[model samples]
Target: MFPLLRVFLSDLRRHPVGTLLPGVALAVGLACVVSSVLVGGAYDTAIQRNKPHTPAGSAVVIRAPGTDLPASLVTEVQQLTGVATAQPRQVTSGQVLGADGRPLNTPASIRVEPSDPRLSTTTILQGRLPRGDQEVAIDEVDAQRKHPLGSSVLIADYRTGKPVKALIVGVSAQDLGRPGGIAMVAAPAFATAHLDSTTIYGMDVVLTAGTPVDAMLPRIEATVGGNYQVETAAQARASEQPSPIGISSTLFVMFSLLAMATAVLVAGAAFRAVTASRVRRTALLRALGASRPPLVVVTVLEAVVIGVVAAGLAVGSGWFISVGMLSVLNSVGVSALLGSTGVTPAVPGLVLATVAVALGVAAAVTAALRPAIQASGVPPVAALSAVPDAPVERGAGVARLVLGAGIVLLAGLLAMLGIAARSFFPLLASAVFTMIGLFGVLGPLVVPLLVRVPGWIAGLVARFLGPAGAVIRVAAREPSRTPRRAAAVAMPLAGAFSLLAFGVVGSASLRDAVVRHSDAANTAAFDTATLLGWGLLGLSVLAAVSGVVATTAVSITERRRELALSRALGVTRTGVGLQVVAEAMLLSVVTAVTGSLIGYLYGVAIVSMLNLPTAVGPPLPLLASLAAVTVLAVLAAAGPAIRGALLTPTNALADN
Candidate 1:
């Protein structure tokens, strides 16, 4: 172990950048997951904090269904045994008028602000609370949109079937747990406007010291009778808190998992290229009688170091990412709807940081293990003489082929079942299996076939060009020859595109139907989901871009000897540059196309299961983004290619 550690240290010292690049890719993914968790937690916490709080001791709620409670009920609740104070919660339904003189169309709960501050749930965020009978306090969220301070708000009174004009004297913070806005007016305002036929709607009963909430619940229920709903403060709070299994939380968790998977693919591809570059070094060690076990140990040890370094880097950057994400959410009004706007992201604790580091290390090691094993198994003589970027196998092995086929079949079955049964679990399971079967298991076999499409196009275009045409054709063929490398580069791109297409198409299909059929609460939830989908798409794009750059750069670096040999054989510097650009662009474009199609199908299947309208047209903007990413990859490849091409053939050969 000590000897292997020495070897690992030596290798790491020699190739620090190569070791760190893969780790950096892993770090991006780890950081994304960590930041997402923090953001989600912050959202939950902000929501809870923004809600109306009960007094310090145990509290009971008495809710009368359909009709407002009589004034006698509030007095009866206050006089009940163990009840210290009973505050009546008087609320009526209304709509706030927009600047255009029409109702805002969004429903709101109009609440009476009592003179006693202890009984009031309203927290003034701007100006002063409503004092005059004709003045009111609009929710901060609504004020930002239309009714600012000093603005006149017209309320559509349901009981009178007429609009009541009131001056907005103040703005109060909105409750995050509840949907829509709350409009607050003083107690006299309710009677003056005749908003509701009855005054008292419900009561908040604070129990006395040492009072058991469980014992009080039965007593309150008996006194209030069967029509009223009785609940403890804890239960009421729980109801207001966002569900753990809600759409937003679910989306965050799912995206985090996907981000980790993407990191693994990216880091693995980088490890493969880095290890390939050290073929001669490995051969020299093997020739000196170093066994395979020692070689594997040394490689794994290096991976461990890479993992730890990546984890540290990722953990450090997580907080900034969380803050930025929260800011974006607030700007888009998602935070305003779900919780408080401008709320700080919850700080991740020591335990969370430790877990993030562990995940980073695990992701890095998982990515490197396969490549390390393959690198160590190379025979000394072959490693000494072989090209650095030579293919390990021409095609997928029989075992892999069988396994991939079985998995694909399982995916098809799951997808069909999901559609037939209208089940989300089966559909989600199918999506997972689809990526695993097509990309993870059968990538080598599939990528080569996909490569041929671009190769054929390059071949035809080469005839139209002069010397550069030959380079283009040769570059296109390079990915096909080394199927594993091509597959690794393609995997992240395909997965990202799939998700992109899903988000784009799914949102389009569901938007109109959801707005038409669902109430404001349901519509708000749907909108939030759409916004969260965009966030996921951003993460996927980051992973995709990183994967492309890392793989393309490594591919060019690995072929230093090949490029030098071509230069020796009289290929111009211009030709070599074109070759580099062609390689990156072709691989990126093909994978992007493949991924989009897969993702579109997945979207359609899910939409069909939900019985929603299926969007027909493809997402053009997302497709354009594929081209944009290809250009970015080409730019990355061009730098290394031009730099290497500047070297004299003799110098390049010597360096290789």
Candidate 2:
């Protein structure tokens, strides 16, 4: 054990970068997972903390039209036992007048500020709450945009269209039920501005603590009449804050899983390269009587070490990333729109660290398993030879072809079902199956053909340029020679871009629907979508960079002999460097185009299925992401390419 440990330590010291290369992707995956959990939890906590409550305690909501609930019923409900207080809810809405004494173009709503402090859903972010008939408060988002604290603002009566002057007293976090800018005024002030302020839409009934809400519901329902609705506090809150928490949570979980899956693919590709590079060394160990089990153990130990290091780094980085995400959301008014002054980021604890490390180790071992097994099974003599890997056997190729075709057929069936039913679920299933069949199962066969588009373009450009163009043309064709590696690199990029394009198109479709019906823009939903889109883009870019780095590093290791021969044939080092960058750029372009097309079509299908108005236009963010990914891929490959190009031809050939 001691001897093996010493050897392992020595190996790590000798090839630290090579041993640790695969863990970079693992670190990114873990970091994203951590950030997602922390941010999601923090937002949830904020929502719960700032939820509307009442002085009377646990509450039940009773809602009915003003005509159904007369003044007599309201008095009777308040007089009932176990009830502390009953507050009538009304919109009392009016248009917001701008500094020019005209109503603002943006639609607005006004509600009477809760007289009871416990019932206030909003936090006063600046100054004091609205006080009397002369003062009002606006959402913090609105205050920042136009009405500053202490500024004079006007509220135009909804019925008479007469403007009432009021002083802005505070900037409050927007209510969760409200989608846009809103004004909060005292009941007296609301009555002064609007004649129909007394119109009641609902009533908040605060019950005594320890009173069974369920038991009271039957009696309350009877009292409110059959047509009226009655609900507990939890139910009412859920109804009020529909979609934001649900949407955000779902997105966070989906992206976290996607990132983890991408990391697994990246790590698998990396491990394949690592084990292949160590073939001769493995043969030497086998010759020295080391068993296959021992060899696999050694690889597992290395993975364990890498996992530990990656997890620690990921946890730390994730903390900063989660905080940054909240800061971005706050800057864009998402938090304010959701009725939060600001959400404090949830700190990752010991349990979270343990879970993260456990997941990292598990993922690392899973990715390394097949490659380690293959490396161990290689005959000593076969491994010692400087020969290329064997091609897929005829039987295996036939099986893969049959299986891939079957999966593709399944995807088609799903698409047909989706069309027949006019449902999004079946279409989504079809897309997922299509990706799995094409990329996961039939990658070798499809990738070569897919890459030819970029290769042909490079060839056209090469005809015009000189030696540099020749390098690029050669690089473009290199991916065809190693289709498996090319596919591995392309798969993650494709998935990332697919999500990006879908988010862009879907957000646009949703915004269009909101505008068409409401005659007002859904700014809050739009901004929230923007936040999630940017988050997805960041993760995608990280995936791209890490994928390119891992694949290019392995390529450099595998092609030392080939590159040395090229140098001997008078290819300049600068030309070799250009080839690496060109290869990365080409793969990125192919993936971007393929994934964007699929995602756009899927988005359209979803919009159509939902019966939304079609307003799908060019997605600016998607285009920008495509450009950014290509540039980052180039940057990721440049360092390794330059280092590989620096290897003297004599040194490379002589070592091999």
Candidate 3:
């Protein structure tokens, strides 16, 4: 056990990047999950904060700006058994002015309330809360930003588009910061201007403690019947979490799961490669009297260690990631309809950190499972034999290829029929087949072919690498000879990259379908689609790219002897590192490109089948996705590449 502990520490110290690469990849994915949740929290908080608050005791705030209820409806609803207080107001938009009289619309809110703190959440900071028909109170943020206390404001009636003037007498604050301005005014002033009985905005209902909203909702609706809506505070937060885009929260959980799956696949591939490459070492360790199960446990432990480290980094990174995502959403101008809530990273709790770690461990375990089995299953003599003791069966390989092709053909047939008839279900079936069948079937065959690309690239790089080029170029070509191992490693990379491509294309297709197929307005459909696409895009890239790096590192790890020999023969460490990096990157690009093509065709087919106008040409996002994956792949490869380059000849060559 002491020897085992020493070896574990020694391996980590010696191969920091290789040992940590999977963890880093998992970290990126976990970071995305954490940041997304945080961003959503920030957005939800902002919605609750930035919007007009219900009076302090209010349990539910319902607004019907479109179908304004008569003021009489609130009087009846207030008489309900569970109701403590009901406040009614008229809602309208106002173009507020600064002391300098310009269009100041940054801060936004609904409901111009009266000067009572018990009914609303406004904190007066300057002068007094507005009490008269000619006065109003502006948000303190906007007051400081431009329209200060005592500034003249112009209110535009939404129905008639008429402007009315009023003075901002006081400054007020909302618990959550609003990006747009919130203003308050005397209730009489709002009523005097908009006297139409149908123009009553809505009512805020506050239930007594222990009175459930659902219970109170029916009674209130019974009082102020027809066209009225009831919503609890929890519902309000959920509805406003991501404005305009009505994607299900379940989908977000699914996206996070998808990211974890990607991490697991990548980690698994990398671990498998590592295990296969270490067969000789494992054999020696067993010969030295170590039991097979302990060695396997130790091997699995490496992945667990990686998971722990990855989770820690991911927790810290999540905040920045969330902030950046929200900023980007805001920049595109579809973050929300009326307001673009500025997001802060959600405050992380112990639960959030624990979830991240658990996810990491899950991924590590998934990755370690196959490799651990492989390492323990083999006899030490068999393990010490040449890399693979037996020849690959050509008949089995051919049979697999045929089965995969058959499935692909069936998928194509399904897609064509679906497109011809304008049916989405069959098209969906086709996508399932295309993704599962193509990757499952063709990945191995293509991997050997793709492996040659890096070998050719090594020739070009050899010029730059000088002495190291020959060594790398030779090593790069070696994968072509071992089709079985190459294919095994390549399948995960292929599947991961393909999924990345599919997610991007599918999001766009779904958006187009929603716009054309549903009654949702074009603006709304597009906004929803755009947000959804971007959200899924992050998950796809992080998961796939990380998987590629992990797989490549594992594969290249087998070359430790070659790397050590190259170093002893006078190749520079930088050159060796560059070779390893190039190999991983080239492999990723080739597979990603292949996957992208399949994904694009599937996206087009899906959109067409949904009876929507098929988007023409490739979108910039698809291209951007490719570039992003490539860059991430490079980053993931860095550690393993450097470790490989740093291998010493004496230690590596003496392994046999």
Candidate 2 minimal-lDDT segment of 10 residues: 387-396
Number of colliding residue pairs in model 3 = 8
Candidate 2 per-residue lDDT, tens place, 1-656, comes to 44555666887999788788889888988898888878777777666544443323438887774343555667878887877767666555567787677877765555565644566544666887676777777766667666788897887766878887888887765655544456454544556555354556677788777778888888788887787878887787666563544545666767787888888888887887778777777786777777898888888888888888889988999899999988888777677656665676778999889999999999899888888898888677755576443322212278888998999999999988997899889999998888878877787777667767756676788767766666656876777766776777778878788777777778888777666666434655675767666675667557555877887887787778778888898888987888888887778777778888888888788778888766666688788888888888889889888987897888877755
lDDT of 3 by residue, 1-656 (tens): 56876787897899787667667557877887777667656555544555554455567766674566776778777877888778775544355544454555443443456666666545465677676666777655456545677777765553565555767887665433323345444455554564223246656787887998877777776676567776775665466444532233344556766676666666665676666666666676777778867877787787778888888888888877767777876655444432333445556889889988888887787778777877766566755565432322122277888888898899989988987888888887887787667555665565656657656776877778676656556646645544544444445445555555655666655665665666544546376556655566567466667665666666556666667877898878887787667666666677668767776677677766555565543466667766876787678668877887777878777745
Per-residue lDDT of model 1, residues 406-436, tens digit only: 9999999999899888887898889879888
The ten-residue window of minimal lDDT in model 1 covers 176-185
Q: Of the candidates shown, which would achieve the greatest TM-score relative to the real structure? A: 1
For the record, the alpha-carbon RMSD of candidate 1 to the native fold, in angstroms, is 4.0
lDDT for each candidate structure: 0.74, 0.74, 0.64
- Structure candidate 1, residue pairs in collision: none
**Model 3: how far is 486 from its true place, Å?**
5.6
lDDT of 1 at 292: 83
